[model samples]
Target: MDNPGSQEVDRIERQESRAQDLHLDRVVATQPEIGPTPPDGGYGWLIVVSASIYHITVPSLLTLYGLVILRAIRDEEHEEEESLKIWDMDLALVPIIMLVIRLLLESWCRAVVKIFNMPRFMALAGLCLTVAGVLLSSYSTDTYSNDHIVNVFAGIFAGTGCALTGQQTDVIITHYFREKLTIAQRLVRMAPSIGNFLAPILIGYLCTVYTGDVIVMIYAAILMQNCLFLASYTRPIYIEKVIRTTYNMLRDAADDDDEVIYSNPNQPTPAPTTQNPQQGTSQDDDNDVVVFNSRKNAREILDPAVQYRERSEPVNNQARFSSDFSAMFAETSSNRFSSNFGSLDVINYTSTSRYQELESIDRDSQNPQPLYRETTVNAPQNNIVFATEPTAGTIRRTATLKKNLITIANMLMDINFYLYALLHLSTTFSILVLGVFFPAYVWLQVPSQTIWWVATTIAMGHGAALCFLMMCLVLPQNINEKTRLCAAFCFVGALGFYGITISGNRSFLILWCMCASFSTAASSILQQPLYNSTLNEFDTTATITTTNAIVAAFVLTWALLKNYEYSTCFLTAAILQAITAVIFFALSFRRRR
Candidate 1:
């Protein structure tokens, strides 16, 4: 038989070894399960092609068709049908209606995605509705008022379909692209220019030849078939199941033991204990478990080797003390500021673990200087890093919905929202004045040159879009600088619009149109990346709020300016744009500093 003291020592040693093994296992379990890499190319190209086609066909077609319908209404046979006063309202309302639906969808897209499982299904449904609407419009042989109602229904279908389909393309591209994302985005953005140029001419000719009803039927047939091709390419990935499985396994393991391994090194160490001779066998056994677990935890975290290594290192005591003082002051100030902001606070949560702190110090010591630096390097982990996945299990849908709603609310509270909204509003006003009123103004100025007006508008818009496409290809993806550059360009466009007010010559008008259009196109393209950058700087991910706010601004400004004369509207647009540019410049400058 073994000696009693030796037996007790052996039992204690075994328990200590078990505790270390448990600690090591916990560390190993904490590592994330890496998922499949995104396919940067391959079948993604087909999706890109489909997206291009959709972009080229849908938006351009609607714009062209709207204008053509307007023209057709104006040119309607008086004997065949009564003139409809609602035609003008129809022309303006079509795009506005489309925009409102798109905005609404955007606001709730994440929830929709969660509920529907995929945007592809929504897109397919939208396609069906679009076809139905077009068919209804085509088949209708009702009075002017009834026909107008049918067209409004058609507008609804086209708007919802185009929004859903168009947005899904963006989602797909973002999922696929990584390194050449800018190039892919540029191609996607540029596709609409082709539609913009060709759609007007094609739709105008088709209306001239076969009537608008025939044109609607043709669009219905073409889109219904094209949507099938689009739907075929859309496939969903099931990484969520894998993530859920991994999470369940981890959680089960943790629940198996009452005393889970504590990874944090900063917590106060528990006192060591020994089994009491007078205590019952079960109590003695429990005491042994607690004593050994506490001993092993302390040894692992507060190892003599690590402590000596840390103590032996050279440090400037003055600098260390200064840094500590500054960090304390900063923390106090941040807490005060956060209290003021309440739920929308910019929380700076540092890991309280000494292990993490030591690791960070080691990294800093190794890299005296890094070639590339992220602004968030010195920021608290919670500020920039989102813990999207939980340690327990898959996040509940209810929780996700609540979280997304909170994010949206916080984003609305951000100052950047107002600034971006202003910028978008100014740009939108200019585009509206150019698109709706410029042609009419040209007709008034030179009724003999109606053909020239159509040609010039198409040429200028397409050319400007092409120029922006080239810029996208050539320019480096510098989001901050691009925002400033785009702002400057917008200012130039504003100046051009202002110049139009004073000028009477056709050459100047054409030149101004070209300049203004080019600037607007460049600004529009750059705004996507610019908005992304601004969101990053704000440390928020609520794109829908930004979009909604911008649209709201547009709606407000449009309401104020819609009844004004074309010249007066343009003049107001210029003034507003000039103010926006100044504010943007100042804000950018301040940010750089």
Candidate 2:
């Protein structure tokens, strides 16, 4: 009783719907599963402990060498007319070299990861290099005629090693402690202060007993402790990437079908036809999938209204699709889908269930739920074992490099970043000046017999600063307040340094040390506010690299100067501190405006 044309149309519609459903099922099946959620505590705490130990040991050497080892070297090599200058310059280059190496590694971190796939292996390599550098330096002191050149070689090794170790620690910490990251960072930050407090006293005492070369060997031995701790850096439980490739492919296919059906109203919807596998036309379908998946945010994909609005736009189908496809996937051919029929676009495929759970948790933040849920054998769980399976695919190194360059350029363009960088440079310069010259100043002021007392006083000052930092963590402070406090501390420190220049009285010196140490510690704590106020996009690695480079430049300039006199150095530091205080005060006012 039905017309033959109508019957044909009904059959075509049913066939198309069935085909679409079948395609969606295949796409869904091909999607990569999400990995397990981070266990915020348990094993994660072990990682925190490892990172803390690293901060305490590796970074503490910087202070130890500056305060204790440098002085010992000066005494041992005192016969050389320019030994002091040469040693100071050589040591100053250590940090500069380290910064340069760190910058290079960070810039090409993706490539480095490819080369050293496992974080633990990278860390082990670093440890070996560091120990080798220290041992080499110790050997150079005794063996080499031109020890400075050898020292420089040692610096290169040490710098590269430290950078690698530090990078892996940061990566692992971030990987392990997602939810409890803030807590872990606070705990880790405390380690440096403890190291700063303890290293001076311990090393100073050892200096009384051992020679410089022997002490260097001892330090190398201590660094070996990192090997035992490296075991704590368990492989980061892999999480599935949250990619929307499957969704995008489905959306694009639907859109293409819609376009075909609507191209001419007079014509009936054509029956779905199979294309020849040998023909090159399937590349067009692959291109469509790539173009649609270019969108970054999941929210955009989830919003039905947005999709409807996009479909309504009067875009030239072939031109727009081709342009978008080229723009998105032109960087790498691997991003494109395979030419075979029914084969899903596996590029950028991510775990769905994990993404949903994380999204849901973010939405219900007020009533937080456990990250992991119990699953049954029959229940659907799309967990991917990242260790066994390649999560997503190899990231394009060139693309990442280009992106980082763009980000750095953008940061450089911002006037606020420059201000923050200057502030950071000033604070670091002051800290370095103190670390490098403070012991020498103390030695000149106090009798040789009473040097231990001065060292103890310095240690106590660091302890006081540690307490102040702990207090700052607890006390809720806005950016304005932190800036004001930093300014005040700088002023107080300037006064303390000026006090030291005027008189060498033991009691007064003790008071000055405490005041100066507290102020120095404040610089470390308060720089956070300066950074927050200035940077629109806060990148930890980039910010650190910029600040370190600035500080290194200043330190190099300082080392080049002929003035090694304790009084002159103290006066210069005081003047710089006062200038920094004024700058901070000005910054605070500008922020208010």
Candidate 3:
């Protein structure tokens, strides 16, 4: 009798304390989830600038190797006889080596991006290797007594370096410039064309006025400058959503029908399914009905306290998993990265909102328990921001690998892939033949004025390369227009090269050489549009590999038939180009039909 009133008051006071705890816990658990901002053009443009520097320097050095060696050999009267033996045959392999390295290392390079967790670091490393290779070649060329040794070492080092640096640059640029991708690519490609245009003039001047030492030194300095630009590529920005929580709809044992109970934390989840109107329930109600009915029918479920415990327990499990994953990966405390290059403070509140809904469901059933955990997802920023954890990154990369393989497999089945491949093969073969044999062809046929014809042919070829770049830059971004131009140019190129094989007149040869140069440049330019139209990256890779293989085949075949007359080589190039034009026209016709 003395404490009955006090006991009743104490019971009410305890209930009030529990309710306050629940409210605080709700606030904590419902905290917003922050994520990385999407990439728009701020620091991304900086990447384009850096890539352009490398584009200009590296390809200029690479593409000019043949011309540089030829000029050196011709100028060195003492070595003129030996030059043909050492320079001509071996120089053909440089582009082949570089392009093959690019073709083979595509998968390995993609892995490097995932494993390093920092593309900028990988890019810097590649730049360093390129610098080292350039220095080694420069040193060897200056000191080495043997011309063969100099060409061999220089080609190996320079080719390897260009391969490494060029691949990384392409990947970085493609990652950053999605919105104005066409314009960005045109700018980057233009750099190489500019390099090709200028490299020959530079080499000719260096050989005629300065020495080989001075030429090699200049290239090393240019490549070193490229390193400064590459340093700005700090980190990669991911566009896809992070913090995905999947929920699976398990079949109900009683009904033998699918029910999304939302009971388990680890179950495989499908996206929200469509609601059945005949049930007179919304999608949300349909999802929870199974769990609601189970709680109502079971005696164990009647205990409100036990039901609350069940719901909170699952949430706690999820929180732990997320916490562990984040900690393991050394990511920002909140799954999002707050970056200066893009918008910040943006949070994906789906997880928080869903948690609150689950908590409310528990409360509605008249079940109450202590919200034991604070459930605060600590929001700390990182200087080096990556999109995912190591495990998640690995899984995603593995999945991407599977997708690439499947896509490649599908392309193998597609007739269009082979058709395009053949067209690229023959066209690229023709284009490379110009660089490989045209200069030599001019030197041989017009020996009385070798210097003039060689210089003019090289100038016109690179001049056409520059013009092609400019056209792609200025033209409307219409695929049909590009296709029409490519066809017109290629047909003209075929006619010119065939004429070159038969024509002996010096003036006519020069004119036809210019025509072939323009057509080859235009044909090469068409590849950019073709790759852009492709649905898969692997398909682009396939086209590149096919083109390189065909070019390599031509180079090796030429080496085997070294005894063949120069005219025979020119005739072969013309035949291949003519075939390419036919295939392209046939492909275009089929597409129209």
The candidate scoring highest on lDDT is 2
Residues 1-593, candidate 2: write the lDDT tens digits. 98999999999999998898765323323344533455578878988898888777776666655555345544544343232332443444444454445544543453475465587788888888878877766644331233566667777787778778777776777666655665576667567777778878887776777765677788889889888887677564443222355567778777652221112223334445557778533212211211333333211112334346456655424232232333333332222233332333333234333334554454567876544322311223443223232334435666778788888888787666765666666556566656656665665565343435656766776777676667656544344455567788889889878887786676677677666766766676666555665574756567666766766666666755564655776777788788878876777766442
Ranking by lDDT: 2, 1, 3
Q: Please provide, for model 1 over 1-593, each residue's C-alpha lDDT reduced to its tens digit, 9 standing for 90 to 100.
A: 88999999999999998898765323323223533444577777877787777767765544444444444443542222232232233444444555555555654554454456475686677677656755765643222433456656765776667656666667767766666677788777767656666665665555556655677677667667767557754543433445566789989887662443333344344445556678533221211212233323432234444456446545323232132222333432222112223333246444333223433553667654532223234645666343344544355766878887887777778767666667666665565556545554444344454433554554555565566556666677765465467668778878878877776577777667666666665666676777776666443336655666567556545644545554776687788778878877777766531
- Candidate 1 pairs with clashing backbones: none
RMSD of each: 21.2, 22.4, 23.0
Q: Give the alpha carbon lDDT tens digit for every residue of 1-593 in model 3.
A: 56999999999999998898765323222112433332546778888888877777776555445554454445554332222332334444444444445445544565566556465577767666656655554533322234455445555555555655666666766656555777776677667656666666666566566555566677677778776787787654342122122111122344453344554343344446567778664333321323543433432112344456546652343432232333322223322222232223234323333234443544466754424112212223322222443698899999989987887687677655654555465555565556545655665555555444466566666676466447666755557734445566767777777877777576677568667766665565566676556424455655555545555565556645565545665576677666666666666655541
Q: What lDDT does model 1 reach?
A: 0.58
Model 1 stretches astray by more than 4 angstroms: 1-35, 73-89, 131-152, 216-222, 236-413, 428-441, 450-457, 496-509, 537-543, 549-553, 556-565
Q: Is candidate 2 or candidate 3 better by lDDT?
A: 2
Cα-based lDDT for every prediction: 0.58, 0.61, 0.56
lDDT comparing candidate 3 with the true structure: 0.56
What lDDT score goes with residue 185 in model 2? 63
Q: What are the models' TM-scores?
A: 0.60, 0.60, 0.58
